[model samples]
Target chain A: MSDAKTAIDVNALLQAIPYARFLGITVDQRGNEITTVLHFSQRLIGNPVLPALHGGAIGAFLETTAVAQLAFEFAGAGNGKVVLPKPIGLTIDYLRSGKPVDTYGRAEITKQGRRVATVRAEAWQEDRSRPIAAAHGHFLLQVAEDAAAS
Target chain B: MSDVDFSPEDLMTMKDVLIEHVPHAKAIGLKVEDVKLSEAWLSVAYSEQLIGNPETGVIHGGVITSLLDNACGIAVQLTLPGRMSIATLDLRIDYMKPATPKLDLMAHTHCYKVTKNIAFVRGTAYHTDEKDPIATCVGTFMLAANRAQPLPTTSKAATEAMKILAQKKGGDA
Candidate 1:
């Protein structure tokens, strides 16, 4: 409910996750809608000839963002242990070619169920109308009870 | 902030960059199908190299993600011109079913829109059995403004080595 109290230091949280550290993703802002930034670098290339960005790299960024979003929400709740949500399913819509640059993405929590959490995210660069891509994800939540009981 | 400066060929070819650089993409033999200014499609032929759990002869989730990531980049390049460097802001993938070994993976992508500094795109990945997708992904990429040209990394070689090691470990196990 309150994103502020549970607000995670984006840099600290991302650094904690090795993969996030690899992508160089940083939390741009913290709240109900968690905003993050992925700095484009040489590490994310998919093709050499045309120099397009890689899809897996993008996917990793998206998946990481989803986890961070849930973490933010859990922190807001202030009563549960920080749990890592594993992505059970996801649907990606590739709208355009992602150039080699610093791309910004924003994610929103659509529904946070007891066991499953649904999230929607849109990415943009210089233009908003033309989004680089959009993603919806299903994350399996790890709750304090589930952990303690285990 | 204004407009990207790349040709259709550049846009399509950019997707190739993903295949060439990313370690997993190389392991799966990802290849481009076609590239237009505003639209692109690509595919990968199933091979022994793509297998994860060899007993089941299923493709690995890493391979599927590679295919979808390349497709999403192509979708963005289709609309933007002239080498606009983009990074994945976020990406979500759904593994509808397990991909069989030796099957062809086709990925189709389109750019939704391109604005001042942001771009939107979408795509789907399927196999010979076009009705079903081994996995589907949606991603959001943002335009990196004031970003310099990309520097080439020999990172793939290290990744390739790791894959080989993994294969050997799998075999031993």
Candidate 2:
């Protein structure tokens, strides 16, 4: 509910995705920001000795965050239907070992072009100042049908 | 190719043990089909629970990321002569196109070179032919991230076997 205009159901959009359900990711929409949560599970562990969350899981969560941001932005632009933004490329840097706890992600659109968007995302566990991983990526967005026709 | 002469059974066990050590690989049902000297091939089948967009039923990009990462790690493991811990330093992936729904994804990775402290890897994910790729990636892993923890049981045995093979190549056998 950050925008003063039309409301978008973030949770419902995530729930429709099968992988999102498997990862147990949920959205926390607040005044001016939206946060995506990744609940920890033993299945997410990649290193049993270190007991660290899988790098892939963290990367995937960050991707979801960027896509969610795009979807919300599209809905706010007066577009009725949401089209899943397709990722063009992604680079993820693992800053720290992801502990066995809940992780949160947020994405900021760095630039949006006519056909592509660039986003930077971060994921953290306990402190926002210290992120466990960071990512920057590009995604292809579909213009609205009316805009396309025009 | 390695100096070590592995029986078919050793290779099979090596592949199985490699996947078993990574819990997420098991969770996502990853299989290590081939592990050459410094190359690896792995696969994961399509499943409904892995679709990123329910409307399109396309598998999420993260699945491909995980598959490529795992393949790279296995490629690095096969390059070493002894037990050494490695952690991913960074990974970059380029998505060529959305994967065809219900088609199993396969990944092949090669660790072409390893410096004293860094290992470099490149990988590709495809459905059938490696020529037709769904995604491609390049990554680096830090070698000897830690030595305090004990190496996995099967890896220990495999390294020991490799050491003996190395000694034989040195004309000591």
Candidate 3:
């Protein structure tokens, strides 16, 4: 019943999603914190001249972090899988160019209402203090059935 | 932005060159279907690799974000007189519905206005109908290098475009 007792597999939850796999995303959970990592790959380059990571790629990775965090929070530990949350909208502010390096993302639940949850996520390349981008997202959470299948 | 005496034909030829440099666009199979001064249309066909929720077979919302972002960026580039370093300063995407599996996603973007340091763009992603969009986005891009501050003429261009779009929808309906 408690989050501490529930063994959540955020990586497994990510692996089941094809786009997450395509993006080469993995999770690092330390206690209650889950930080999603986007592995550096050549295919992620948007500006070949500057060799910066694609903006869309960074946006997607950050969004994935938020969704995984939401699932980790709501999915009961020992549950086989977590039903994925759907994003209603996202506002991404690119503070700095995404360097072509391994990027890290983390999401914090800013607000949790009845049918919706708001999350704030940020991505950093080298220094956590200096984030390359940040996002505020709204998600539609299906709590009526929780993990009930269609 | 001042006028760039470019014909739609001139910009149309640069569509491939516009997307060839971005590896992510190629990785996701994004193509520039059409391009004009301050306007662009791009599309990405659905594939298993792009699916978000495998159970329902819907394309990931990220794909839509990428498509819309690129479309907005390309529209800004098409507006400029020459190629310049344009960075997406910010982008906001509003999802209207999940993308239908196996249906190609297309986005049309317009850079309606440009100021000294920024270019404003609005875009919509849809299967075949723009009115029934899967997602809509508005973004601002920071322009670098050769640029100028000019009167707002593109808004008129945008209004003309709206009339054309309205007529097309009416005909389709």
The lDDT ranking, best first, is: 2, 3, 1
Clashing pairs in 3: A6-A77, A7-A77
Off by over 4 Å in 2: A1-5, A146-150, B1-10, B148-151, B154-173
Ranking by TM-score: 2, 3, 1
Q: Looking at model 3, what is the TM-score of chain A?
A: 0.91
Write down the lDDT of every candidate, Cα atoms only: 0.63, 0.83, 0.83
Using DockQ, give the best candidate's number: 2
**Clashing pairs in model 2, backbone N/Cα/C closer than 3 A:** none
DockQ of each: 0.13, 0.39, 0.34
Candidate 1 vs candidate 2, lDDT winner: 2
- Candidate 3 lDDT over A2-67, as tens digits, reads 545476788988999999999999999888778899997767767654556788999898889999
* Candidate 2 interface RMSD (Å): 8.7
User: For residues A1-150, what per-residue lDDT tens digits would candidate 2 score against the true structure?
Assistant: 554555688878998988888887999988657899999776676766655778888889999999988887777664557777889999999888887789999999999998899999999999999999999999998866743563
Let me know the TM-score candidate 1 reaches against the reference structure.
0.52
DockQ of 2: 0.39
Q: Which digits, one per residue and each the tens of the lDDT, describe model 1 over residues B62-135?
A: 45677776677667755665556666655666767667666787887777777767776667778865567666
